[model samples]
Structure formats: C-alpha cells, structure tokens
Target: MNPNLLTPPRRHGERPTTTGLEIPHDQLDMFSPPRVRAELVKQAQALPGVFTGPSQVSEPSSLALRLRQPLGPWEAFLHPSTDEFGHIHRAGFLHLTLPRPLLAPLVEAGWAEQHPISLRPEWPDTIVMLYAPRDDGELDVVLAALRASWQQASTEKGR
Candidate 1:
C-alpha cells in the first residue's frame, strides 16, 4: 500500500448541499451534516482508485465516489435524495470488506453493522457499513474506522 495514501490537512472536494448530494434530506442529522459529509467525500477522494461523476450520480448534484481497490460504490453526499437508479450511497458511511474477527468487535461497539457480502459479490469477505459520526468525537472514531477499512482493502490487493 502507498505509505502516503491519505494524509490529514489536505484539501477536500466541493461542498455538498441539500440539492446535489445523493442522500436525501431526511437522512441528514447532527451526526452527519453537509459539512461533515463534504469532509468525508473529500477524504475518500484523496485515496487511490476513487472517482466522482454522473456514473455514480443520476443528477449533477449528487456527490459520490466509486472506489476500485476494494471495488465498491460509496457516497459522501446529502440532499438531491437518492433515486431508484442512483448508485450513490449514504454519506459519512462505508461498506467495507472486513474479516469476521473485526466485524464482531465493531458491531458490539455500535460502530458498524453487517451489510452482507451479497451486496458486493466481488469482495472476498463479509462487509460492514460504518455509521455516520454523531459528533466531533464520533467523527474521529469514524475516520479511524474508515482509514482501517481502506488499509484493509489495500493490503488485500497487495498494493
């Protein structure tokens, strides 16, 4: 894996609004606001094998990314609610390929939930969706989890 994959103090992408984001307004909460969502998208885009576009968004407003290393779809967006054909997913959330050993602890800690490998058959192991952070403290925790997930994906690919 690249040692300098994602470092802090980096620039993020465009700010997500209630109109162009993939997630709907009802889904937004203090846990995951537009600012936080934008930050998450910015960070994810900083990693390798990530792309943002109409391929992930049905509309021009949707802010989402398609990752290749782990090979999955993720969104760090809100607003412009998700339509039936949209591939953009929840903001501040992640679906990752995690080992069963790791999954159990995350679930017990209320940090994650099993998302079923059926959603992404190409993945080698079971995946989980880490929830959006509820506050700054939770954002830190969520970022750590996301980093770990990205590491796992990179390691699996022998990057």
Candidate 2:
C-alpha cells in the first residue's frame, strides 16, 4: 500500500486525553457516542475477512476483530496468542495493528498512539490504540485505519 494513502489528514483540535499506561487504556474525551460506536462496530465487523468475537487479549466486554484467514506477518495481531487484528474497547477506542510505515504517521497526525505494551521488546511496535471516532467523519478515518489493518492481515507482507 502507498504510504501516502495510509497517511490521513491531521485530526482537528488537540488529541483527546487518554489514560496512557493504564490497564484499561482509554480515551477520556472526544468520545464516540453510543450510536456512533455501535455503527463503528457494525461496519468494522462487516469488513471482508473479519469476524467479531470476545477479545482474546482484552476485557470480556471488548469486541475482537479477527481475520478468518490471516496471511500477513505476526505484526498484524495485537498479540501472538490470537489472530485478532483489532478490538474495540467498551469506551470505543480501539487497539489494532498497522504496518510499520503507517504507525509514526498516524501517531504524529493524532489519530492514534502506540499501545503501552508495544514498548516492550516482546511486543510488536505495530500495535496502536486508535482514538474513538467522535463523529461520522472521524468514523470514516477510523474505518480506513481498520481497513488498512484488515489488508495487512489478509496479505503476506512482512513488517
């Protein structure tokens, strides 16, 4: 994929506040309302090669997005214990894997940040916590990021 294509425009306003290293990592502001959050889950589950399930690495209430047939590198997963490419928190933020090239750009653009666990040597640095979509426009961008993750998981590309 073209790096430019994955580079979304800088998100407007300041980055939403988050509980950076907390176990229940969460975005405290710029929330995706219940309706938008539901829609995001609905649309993300509809993405090709994906299915919704209880997260293998998150709270039981969190929704995990898994690839039915993964062909990409291990970096496509939030953890090696599962094929999950992403999972939406009850608070609406998401933890997903992105291609290495897309990582810094997304973070710099203020759409996401590296997952706290990702700082560990055992974890893939590709893991990131995508901020919640506060509205339709942001939802589109979040979905695009999810699609990028789906594409990465459905291909054989290396990190």
Candidate 3:
C-alpha cells in the first residue's frame, strides 16, 4: 500500500458525516479531494485478490447475482441469500465516496468482502453499494464498469 497515497488528511476538528456503518472507533478524519478522487479510481481499479486475497461463498445472494465467478453469478439470484459469499446491496454510491480517504480502515471493517460496490449514479451524485468481494473474480465486471465510469468521472473532474 502507498502510505502517501492512502494516508488520511489531518484535520483537528474534522469529522466524518455519520453514516449507518459508523463503528465505535471508526472515525473518518478529513478526506482530501485528490485523495478521494484517487481512491474512487483505485478502489474501482484494484484487483480483488490484493484486498481480499481468496474467494469463497459463505452466503450467496438470491437476486440475479449469485455465487461463482463474475457476470454469470449476477444472473442467478432473485432474493438475497444469507449464505451468498458476495456483496448484495441497493443504491449507495454517495456513501462510498465518504470512505475514499480511509481504505485501510474500510478493509479492516470488512467493507470489501466479495461483492462489487454496486453503483447508481444520479445527477451530480452517485449512489453505490460497496459489496466488497473477498475474491478478485468478483471485481472483474465491476472494475470494467469502474473504468468506464472513471473515464466519465475523470473527464468531468478534468483529470
């Protein structure tokens, strides 16, 4: 991990806008614009194995996206399953941007388990559900999507 790249910004009174996932000790310090942007790009581009290492199906989703590999599994579930070893979520990209500067803490909290961070970008904002997958394969399609989205985001941000 790149220390300079991943380190959170230091702001004395800065506080994380509380989300539903706030842990007792998990405090999101200040996040820089560049850092946040990079994370948005990196997290989307990161290989699944680097973060989670291996793949397993503990509780597969029942909603079109199931347990197995990438795209194929997505066509399997209709109802979210408890044993599905993937990330199942609704709309939530905005929440994801909040953690852009805190990669280490997010990983430690099991945010990137095995599900791709599902996204629904809206006008001026994107709603995404970061279904963290433990395996690299799970991120395949997501990464591709991210690449496409990133291109647009970068263009919009003037990268």
Candidate 4:
C-alpha cells in the first residue's frame, strides 16, 4: 500500500468532525473530484492480480477490476466505475464488496449503504451484498473496504 495515499485535503488522521464521527483513517474530500477518483483507480491497480478495464456489466461504459482468477465464481473484483460520459458517477456513488462482519458494522456506523438488490439478483451471496461509499467523509473507509475485497479476491482465494 502507498504510505502517502494521495487523498484530497479534507483532513488527516482519525479526527472527529462536526458529525462526531471520526473520519476514515485517511483524509478525503467532501466529494469525488476527477483527481480524487483517479487516485482511487490508481490504488486498485496497485493490488496484486488486479487488472483495470471496462466493466463486465452491460453498459455503455464503466470501469471495473478483474482478478487473474475467479473469486469462487465472479471475475469482477471491485466496482468504483465511471459512466460512459466520463463522469465518475452517473450519480455520485460507487459500489464495493465487504465481508458480512465488515458490512454490518459499516452499516450501523453509517459508512456505507447496502447496494440495490434489484440490480443483479443472480449474484452469489458472497457478492450479492455490496456497499456504496458515502462521499461525505468516508472515502477512505470505502477505499479500505475495496482494498479488503481485493485482498479476499486475490490473496485469500485458493491461489
């Protein structure tokens, strides 16, 4: 991992903000600027066995990560995709995978939201539950969640 994770100048360290919630250990901006989003893509690329490319999802365009091998059944590793118009978000959200233990705490803590189930019902349970990062002050938490997914999909797999 990069020691100096090139984050936006929101703040550094685990400091408490107006909301009384300690922001992610890493600093982040209030929103996803192009540079900030590019940094996210860069981090995902640095992971082992991760290859960045167009999403496997049927869309006009989007970014996604593919593992060198399948994690059980899914090939996609992470989902911080961009839209066809080159917008980082069609809206202003991104999806990521997290283990149940991680997911529950993050949900209760208000760091993430469960992905829309109607989007893809065929996904396995391991992947069925996804989370969208909050742009408020949780990009780092979101990035950390994505990193965990990469670790599970790449290193933790039966490689």
Candidate 5:
C-alpha cells in the first residue's frame, strides 16, 4: 500500500481513553452516539467485498467486517476462523489490522494505537485498536482507515 494515501490527517483533539487489552479492550471515552455508530457500521458494511457477521475473535455482540474472499495469507487476519481484518466493538471503537508500514503513522496521528496482544513475538505487529468516532467527520476518517484495511486484507501483497 502507498503510505502517502493510506496515512490520514492527524486526528484532532486529545485521544480518547482506551483499555488497550484483548479481553476487555475498549474505548472508555468519547463514544460514538448510537446514531453515528449505526451509520458507521452501515457504511462499512457497504464497502466493496465486505460482509458483516458475528466476530470470531471479539465479543459476540460486536460486528465483524470480513472480506468476502480474502486473498492474502493468514497474517492478514486477526484470526483465521472468521477472516476478520477488523471488528466494531460494542462501545464503538474498532480492532483492526493494517499494513505494518502504516501502523506507526496511524498511531502517531492520534487515530489508533497498537493492540496489546500484538506486542507478543508470535503475533503480527499489524493489529491496532482504532479509537471510536464521535461524529460524522471522525466517522469518515475511521471509514477511510477501514477501507485501507479491507484493501490490505484482500490483496495478495498485503503482507
């Protein structure tokens, strides 16, 4: 992926609070209102090659965004059972995988942080916990991030 295009503008405002862990990982502040969350999910599901379903690696209540046909290898997924590159948490934040090259920029820009689990030697370093979107403008940035993730997960060269 081209880092230039995938790199989003620095997110405005202080970063929302987050738990930064796997089991209870979540955004603790600045949650998206129900209407905004719903709209974000709707638009994400409408992206090309995406389909929503129960998340195999997250809380059952969360929405999994899976590629209809994942072309990349297992490294592209957070878990192979669902081929999920990302999922929207109940609290409205997201857990997703991005290309390794994009991780630092995304985090430095205040858009996301590295998933704690990814710190382990066995895990891919691409996993990140994306902060929740609190409004329409933020939702647009989140969707753009998700779209980059989808493209990475679906392409053979994603790794």
Candidate 6:
C-alpha cells in the first residue's frame, strides 16, 4: 500500500464527500471457505480500528471497519452482507461497500482496491454490504475466501 495515500490532515469541519467508486463484491474467491473465514475473524481481532469486532449478524459473521479522520464520525463499515452467487468459476470474488468519502483514500492506496466493483448511487451516503467467495474452482471456497479477505483487508487497512 502507498503510505502517501493516507488522508491528509483535515481542518476543524472539513469532510470529504463521495465522488465515485467501483467496489467489487461479486468477484472474490478463496481456496478454503471455513478456514479462510476463521482466519478473517482472527485477523480482524488482531487488527486496529475494528469496533464491535467481527461476528455473525442475522446472517453470516463479518468484520467491519470505520474511519473518523476529519469529522465527528466519518465512518465506513466493511462486512459480509450477502451470500455467494451459488454459481461461478473464480476465486477472490466478494461483495463489499464503503462510504463515498472513503473512495478517494482507498483507491489512492492501491489499484487492486479498484476494479469491476460496482456502486449504488441510489442509496444514501452509506455503502451497502456484500460478500464474495474464493475461486478454488468452486463457489463455496470463493465465498469463504472473499469473506475472509474483506475482513482481513479492513482490519489491515484500519491499522
């Protein structure tokens, strides 16, 4: 990750608004689903800026990352929001979302952070959550890997 991409110091009340972004939640896959999910939870606990920790919601368990660099609570949450497509042929597939303000900083961090990932401008400022699985030549693995990576990446970045 590019260290310079970090958010610059902000003034007393300056907050960034959403410009545009491409977040891919349907293209992530992994080698092993359950194992990867476990690793994700472990990593989330180990990483910083992970509040409420990674756990199972009404659905599957997920890790969430929130940021508050420039305002009272400029936050973004990343967690498993949907299930695998049940059919696909790739790993590293996932569904993820973030606040519009976070787009610039995240993309500036690296190119892999940006790609075929889609967006929903219809929603409010908050990004809806999604999930992706790993591409172990199967759908389950892809979902597992995607979920784990999402949690791990958020934990890693927040640190």
Best by lDDT: 2
How much lDDT does each candidate structure score? 0.45, 0.85, 0.28, 0.43, 0.82, 0.31
TM-scores, all candidates, are 0.52, 0.90, 0.24, 0.57, 0.88, 0.30
lDDT pick, better of 2 and 3 = 2
Q: Write the per-residue lDDT of candidate 6 for residues 113-140, one digit (tens) a residue.
A: 3323233343323333222322222333
What local lDDT does model 3 show for residue 114?
A: 17
lDDT of 2 by residue, 1-159 (tens): 222535678888999898898766777888889999999999898888888889999887899998888788877887864579999988789999998888888899899988889888998889899999888878888888888888998887654
lDDT of 1 by residue, 1-159 (tens): 222213322213322222212222222332466677667767766766655664332344544444454422222211122211112244555444444456666666656555543244443444455566545555666566566555554443323
Tens-digit per-residue lDDT, 1-113, candidate 3: 22221332222232333243322111233233443433444564353322221213222211112222222122122112311222222121222222233334333343321
- Find the candidate with the highest TM-score and give its number: 2
Poorest 10 consecutive residues by lDDT, candidate 3? 58-67
Per-residue error at 135 for model 1, in Å?
1.7
Which parts of model 2 have CA positions greater than 4 angstroms off?
A: 1-6, 157-159
TM-score of 2: 0.90
* Candidate that beats the other on lDDT, 5 or 6, i.e. the better one: 5
Give the alpha carbon lDDT tens digit for every residue of 1-159 in model 4. 221222223333332222212221112333455555666667667777667566554232445666665452242333332211111232223444555456555545545444443235554233322222334344565566666666656543445
Residue runs of model 4 more than 4 Å from their true location after superposition: 1-31, 71-92, 118-121, 126-137, 156-159
Candidates sorted by lDDT, descending order?
A: 2, 5, 1, 4, 6, 3
- Tens digit of lDDT per residue, candidate 5, span 10-90? 789999887756546678898889998998799888988888988988888999998888886566788645478889987
Give the runs in model 1 whose Cα sits over 4 Å from its true position: 1-31, 54-91, 117-125, 156-159
